[model samples]
Target: MLNKFLDEVCSHIRCKMAHNDIRAELTAHIEEMQSAGKPIDEAIAAMGDCAEIGAKLDKQHKPLIEWPLIGLTAVIVIIGGIMAFTNDYVMNHSGSDFMRFLLFAVLGITAAAFFMFFNYTKLRDFTWIIYGAVWVIFIGSLIMGTRGNVSYVFLNWIFIAIPLLVAFAGFMDKLRGKGMNGLIISTLLALVSLIPAVLTARRAVIFLLVPFFIMLLAAVYKRHFGVNIKSQKAFLYSGLALTGLLVILSVIRNPYRFARMTDFITNVPEGNAWLISALRDAISSANWIGGADIVYSYAPSVAVPNLMADFALANVIITFGWLAGIVLVAAIIALIVRMFMITRKVKHDFGYYISLAACVMLSMQFVISVLMNLGMFPFMGVSLPFVSHGGTGYAANMVLVGLILSVWRRNNIIGKVPRENKNIQPLVEYADGKNNI
Candidate 1:
């Protein structure tokens, strides 16, 4: 009878993905009634109309489409396609580059769709596995030894860092209520994760490290790891001190990097600062509607060495005008804001952590990338999200988007019904043995 009732109820639910959880929740309620010595028929009848109950459950558990985000992503991809077209045809004169971008764009979109439907909460159970996988990949990258291009090593770590950090969030959650020991353990793990980036000796590590630290410090600030307020403050101070010390040590060790920094600050004409000057000059000379003549006169037709990736923003402003650049920036900003909004609506702690980390990472990448283009910050090889032309980066950004969408999709649903079933309520009432709506 209970199965029949469930079947009737489920028949009204359009979301088949939610059926198992709904079944489990309804089963728990029916079982509770049976344990209370209520007749099954009476309990089933008292639960109200199957169709109405299922309809309400369906409404509550319905997947959120996040169309605004989706639309924005599409618009940005179109913009990227235009940039690729321009870069290939007008600049590189290689007809093949645009097709490559198109292939990756399709793959990225497909990846996002897969992750959108994927159950991200399952990641919580495999936190350590993911953490270990990151370590293994990092080791493998080292063994492979750059293979003539250091980007091979960089790519391996870059793709893994986001997921590793997300897993760290889950790891931290598991340590809640363990007090100072938990804090120490989590901090150790966080530092351990930084080893690969540090060993790579790439400033891009800054992009990964900053966001992960934000996630860690945020957890500490909220007392999520069971540390008292004073201890949290001490942790914060200690972290800042450690960061400063590491930065100083890094500069002392990498004399060439230090020289580049000094040159940028001193405005040495032949140093890396020239890239910044060129970017500014191009922007300054740009007409608001068309390509800048100054850029074409001085630089390659693409306007920069890495016009498709690191300095894509400069190309946008130089080739398409500030008006087009502003629209692209606005779309990226909207996507970041949309990701931030998702953090608020996520009910599950795991989902919340993943979304929050992804948001912070995306926001930081966008800020740093823009700064790199504008010459406010050193070029750390940070690519603009979605707008940049690296296949790995494009795919990684899409995966993050998909994970966030997965979180939003299941915001009101749970994979497992709690044993107590406190949130489960009667769908109908019985008054004087009469069915009441």
Candidate 2:
């Protein structure tokens, strides 16, 4: 409900006092001119561009770096590296193994910094191209992966497609406004990646499906494009129930494919229980303080197939003790909560959706990975985001973090904002012989 003058003022100035004072000065001038039959737009336009005024205000209010959040991430990265170092397997088992980890970390940090400083909305122009390319590469990989294990290429596709899909969803204003579009979008987006997961590896579709639900809920709750599912109680509960049932059924039907999913409930061993059992024992061995070194771990090495990547948090407890694991978990949760806070301040719905999607994706990864590692969930091979050591998952996740940082940067600057702020009348009025309108 902002007037043109106020809206224009906000675009340039981040200082609240300057905004209010200048807006107050212009309000009566605008109203009086309108009362005299002068169009409001003309009156507003006569006040001159807010840029010079904003430039004056910019000296008073500059965007500061989010050092606390950055500090937390740096701490987490250092801890992850330290955890990897504690493993005799990573340090002494092979040459260049540790170097590969360092490379991914550096790449991740670089990508994150690039996105944080760049103009995020510029992607709006290229989103369609990015979206089309994602589907093309992914679908092509899915087809090729069917013949043999092309998972490396497929993983690359998944990494590229996910963030780009989030970007694309942010820009789909028309589609968003059309109501059943959430359901349509949910199914389509879920299926796009789900198909690849199912074709290549069954029962891992949770990664694909979780984001659909997350994006849908975020869009609805935030009222992006004003779309609604209607029947909140029925929709939310039913959607969750259906998802749970599907997960249960997916595990039950494919016992051979998964590692003893119903161990707690059914007490029956499945064909693929070996790796799962090893992972579970490794996680469960820790009490308040975890094992000091990987030599003492229940698992032979952190260099084991799933140990470093999939069961990383479990590996952390094994190497650093439960206290460090608790700290790691708390740090991760804090970062996710920070993302929610940032999402609230974003001025654009597109940016909002991107932030929400990033939060959703990261939260989903952590929850699924932790549960799987601890032997409480069925989805296997999920990585613990930045904490895990794989190049692909780690780098892709860092890019998502970059997306979150991009949104946070946008949130910091008050600007040509969304529709809700338009048409708003100024609250503070003042006499200004200053600008001589």
Candidate 3:
């Protein structure tokens, strides 16, 4: 009995000691016991009851609240507050912009907190309902939504509604087998919602499709490739087919997409010199920390800096400068890499699919944003994540991060299911072949 107890205690100690310091101290005590002429088991027994040690170790390693994501939320909130104040300051001290910012910020924080605390399994089962609701709200917006002269359809309610819907749908999918379906539905809904926007020449809506395209492409890739594609010719063909479709669509809708196809194509100056000059000046001023005040300033009679749709990239470059541009790109790349890592580590199909969806979303956003900035594409007016000053875009991005964090938390809690009723069957199980009748 003593030997058994000592062995259990030693094992507990090994499992709990994550650092070298603890290991060294424990080893020294074991050595001292041996030098005192006690046998190994007897020496271990002399160390006293392990109940206290076991409890201590458990306390040490117990999961605390995730801090990194909390820190990110804090940073976002702070930056958002500053942006709101600046916007208000610029708008003759009217608090309307700040109020809008607060509304979006509060919604985003609430959604994030819910995702962090809710049981993922419950969310997963309701994926379809959430998916359907997004489209319903979107179509309803078309009927009741206010129209803007610049864009065909402007649904303020739907703008807020869709992100909340997507966040919930994403949550459900992340917790269940049909999670990929949620992504697919979300992508389809996003595309469908943009139809009116596109018809009205709302170029801002076009950028929303970038994420949809990426999600669709990833889904096709996974479906065709299965678990491993290296040995499968069918998967290779499927990948080619999907890529071909995307290319065809791009060419049909936006022929300018092919301008960058050939390396020899050159930029046309085409009377845009003044616009380019202004952009350059703005960027130079910002680089020296003196441009924010002037960038938004327009002569009372002159238009508010509306250039060609292709000038969006120039706007970013001019507004933020080269250094900030590089940092933005690096941060986006890091997010993509991290998402991929999480996808790889997840054992559940739901978690894997959700992670992949997020990966596609972030990756596509980065690529399109960079492409637009470089004048390789038209300016679609999509706000850059974490830097742009739009309420809807900021809220949508916050929900995206919340979903990703939820998945990360779920993955970390693997093999650590919350205590449940013993009478309930496991939610999932694998066959062990021992119950043959």
Candidate 4:
């Protein structure tokens, strides 16, 4: 009985060894045959039964892992949280609990809509229609809008209209699985839309100039580094020409912008002494960190009431303190860097354009907000993104974020590189063999 058991154990070991050798030899032979230009089935047939080879190859090539969506989800959630927190602060300062809730609710819905819209993958088809609607809203703002000043319009309609139009257009296109032509067109349309705002706002046109010029720079950058080679020269020249005309017109109307330009050039004492003083006072009033809850009030020293809108950064510094101010600025910088990195990784034109536009929007807000607070640039009522205390500004920024998320999602789906399996032979071997034949 002992001898029989030992013999049986030996037989089992030999069988296992034979099976392992067969697998290794079969795998190597398949690679060799493929490299020598044999068809996959024929190569398998030459080695052994077709059924066995098919089963093994099928198991080897089966997808073992799926792409991670969590990172992208986290980014979207973080942006939404930032927006909500800022909106809550603004609403609380205004002493309107209802508005605070409303703002947060709108922001939450907007974030959800963005996630859903980008996930669908048809954002490229409605480029022209979406583009046209952007223009229509701008024009409509001129006709039916209430005036803030000679050149400023209270066309809050645009804030609502632009997002809805983009969503519908993006949704339609995503269903069709097209490229982001709509996104490209929408960006160009945003440029054209700025024209009417400039024309209507007249002397107040500096508001339009700052955003439009920054956007133009973004477009040029996208064309240069983002692989958009179509009619780039025309777009660049047109933007430059429009900016020049606006600069000339601005000089004629509000000599202050030109004066600031001259002051900047001549190194005049355009120092923001009053603004800086107010900022210092505000900072001293609150804790350096975790004091975003404090809302101190201030009346502008007579020389800078118009600077109220422009001096929001100073206000934030005063109310939140220097450390909070620095943190805010650092956050903006980090966001811009993130955008640049995302754009660089995007291989598709639509994704690249969206990321480029977002970077432009955020960068413009950051530079202008800082300059306005520092009193380097003329006051232009432009609110800082994610930090400013305005419903319209916050909502508009959310829409921009949504569109960016859409582009980013599509880019990941189409352009993600697959991980390599060391067990598998190189795909190029089969192709090289065919070429030789």
Candidate 5:
């Protein structure tokens, strides 16, 4: 009967790492009871049934798949493909671009589902590997030359780097426990990402950089960086103030950038008014529903230069009119907001950061794209995540969506430790020496 109890447990338990420890713990519990004057049979009987307990633990360890959330996002992206279908370039170019959008959209959703349903926590192991791969891309891009056409790897590194930033939050959590070295260690870890951003030299890198800092600061503010929350926040506000000052400095230092900034603001240069004027004319022509002839005839240049990329939203508003644009923008804002709401369910610091990072990245790009179209900001060619027609952009965006979904599905759940089996017990019948029913 003594041997039978361990055998039943060993057979039911799946994670081999915990097997021996569980065995030792259970044996000690029985021996402790025996030493307290109970007989072996009575002591073992006190432990109860192993099978019932094992089943409960099994449920806790299993990965959950949130089908409704996954399906909603999948459908949203596909619905976004609607914008691509009606665009001037999409229709005239034999629909090849739209086809690419569909293919990559599917690929992205599939990749995300694969990651989502799997053990996402295992990704913490390769956080640095993701960081290293992005660094490799940055270095390779430099050697290959950033001019002319960009490579696939280089273009998608932003998406890859964002996930690494999310995972890095867990590393920060460890350092927070380390005292003074914790802040230094976490700062160095952040530099891994900044090196690549500086090398790329794309002002647009702000799309990725902002969230990394926001989330890193948020995590650190929550004590993931070993500093008091108030201290980290003071530093965060100081950094923001400094960033604004530098932007002002940058515009002052660079003649061309400043000229564009000034022209965008006041339209002082009649020459640059064409860009802003074109956007206004396009929007104005769409009298709630759209006067397609007016936009094509009066504001052709606005949609022509980057119709399907940076200006996809402009195309949607023009073609489909005000209601369509409002609905699409609302949907995107809702998606980001929903992501934040989901983060509340995530217990781990890294999971919270990943979900929030994706939301911030998507939100920043959307806001910037709209601002760029309206001539409020210089054109940075940032694509609207789901709406943009680029393959790499769409695929990367979908994957991030999946990552958010993965965080939600697996929130606070450990990969291998079954909740029910956490406390195994000796079968009461066997423990009582009544081996048979």
Candidate 6:
């Protein structure tokens, strides 16, 4: 009778993903009725007509298409294409760079579409495997690198770092109930992600480590670690202190890094000073709408090598004027703000963690890129998310955006049981009276 009833109810539900949840809920309702001394028939009848109940559930569980996010993404993509095209036209006097930009944008959009439909929950089953794979690849690259291949081995760590960020969130989900042991393990796991930075690019490592920690802190704050409030706070401070100590130690040990850190403060135009000087001058001379006067007077001086990649934001400001740059930065910030807001709406642990991770990572990269261009921060290997011309970086960011949208799409359907009511397990037994049926 139960199986037959469920089949009938599920027949009315169009979303197959909601079927298991519907079954669990309705079965629990019937079990409650039975506990109240009602017979099986009475319990089954207690639920409303199967079709009506299923229809209502279907309505409640339908996927949400967040138009605001879609609109924001469209705006950024269009603006990025314009910025890339115009900058290329000014620089190379041809459309080759614009053509390359279109190719990568298409590739990125395709990746976004694929991950948007991909069931992110499936990543749970292989979370540890994914975690291990990231480390293996990171380590293997260095081990396999010969002097001739050093550039290949170390430079592309961003690809490895992005996966680590995603996988770390899933890993945190797996550690939820383990208490202090889980906290210690997660700290170690996160710290390992930073060690590679000392050996490779610190900027790429910062990209992974900062966002990775943000997710960790968020998880702890949300009580995902099953730790008490006091322990959570302690963990938070301890993590921060450790990070500070590491930074101090690294700066003291590395003269080049220390010098770069102090350059902004000391007003010293030493290493990479020419690029920074040109960027500052371009911004100061740029008109509100048209191109910078500096560019017209002496284009080659301000036309740095990475005008399309690491310094795309600067290029936008110099080529299209400060107003255009401000609008672009504001739009990117608004998008990141929207993503962070969406994290609060996510029901599942994995969804919230992953989305938060991506949001913070994107936010950090965007902030650093802006500051770097403004000469307020040292130049780094960071890119302005979608506006940058690097194919790999753009595609990776699109993947992150796709993952966030995926979580938001299913926000209504994949319901989470509240912590307070978690012990009331639904008796989903199928064995009793099944043989007779």
* TM-scores, each model vs. reference: 0.85, 0.74, 0.56, 0.54, 0.78, 0.91
lDDT of each: 0.75, 0.64, 0.49, 0.48, 0.64, 0.76
Model 2: per-residue lDDT, tens digit, 42-81? 7767767677766776665565466666776777787777
Q: Please list the residue runs of candidate 2 whose C-alpha ends up more than 4 Å from where it truly belongs after superposition.
A: 1-64, 88-97, 139-146, 180-197, 201-204, 225-252, 255-259, 264-270, 283-299, 302-305, 412-437
Measured with C-alpha atoms, the lDDT of residue 361 in candidate 1 is 75
**RMSD from true fold, candidate 1:** 5.5
Per residue, candidate 5 scores C-alpha lDDT tens digits across 197-276 of 55544553566568767775666656655546666667667766987898899889998877766676775536655666
lDDT of 3 by residue, 345-379 (tens): 65544555555555555555556656655544443
Candidate 6 pairs with clashing backbones = none
Q: Rank the candidates by TM-score, best first.
A: 6, 1, 5, 2, 3, 4
lDDT at position 56, candidate 6: 80
Poorest lDDT segment (10 consecutive residues) of candidate 5 = 412-421
lDDT of 1: 0.75
Off by over 4 Å in 4: 1-94, 97-102, 105-109, 112-121, 138-192, 202-249, 252-312, 415-437
lDDT of 1 by residue, 3-43 (tens): 78888998988777677767766776876887899888998
Clashes, model 3: 4
Could you tell me which residue pairs clash in candidate 4?
A: 121-174, 122-173, 122-174, 123-174, 124-179, 127-182, 151-201, 282-318, 283-318
Report how far residue 59 has shifted in candidate 4, in Å: 16
lDDT of 2 at 232: 37
Ranking of models by lDDT: 6, 1, 2, 5, 3, 4
Off by over 4 Å in 5: 1-62, 67-72, 88-95, 144-160, 163-167, 267-273, 290-304, 374-376, 415-437
Query: Residue 313 in candidate 3 has what lDDT?
Result: 33
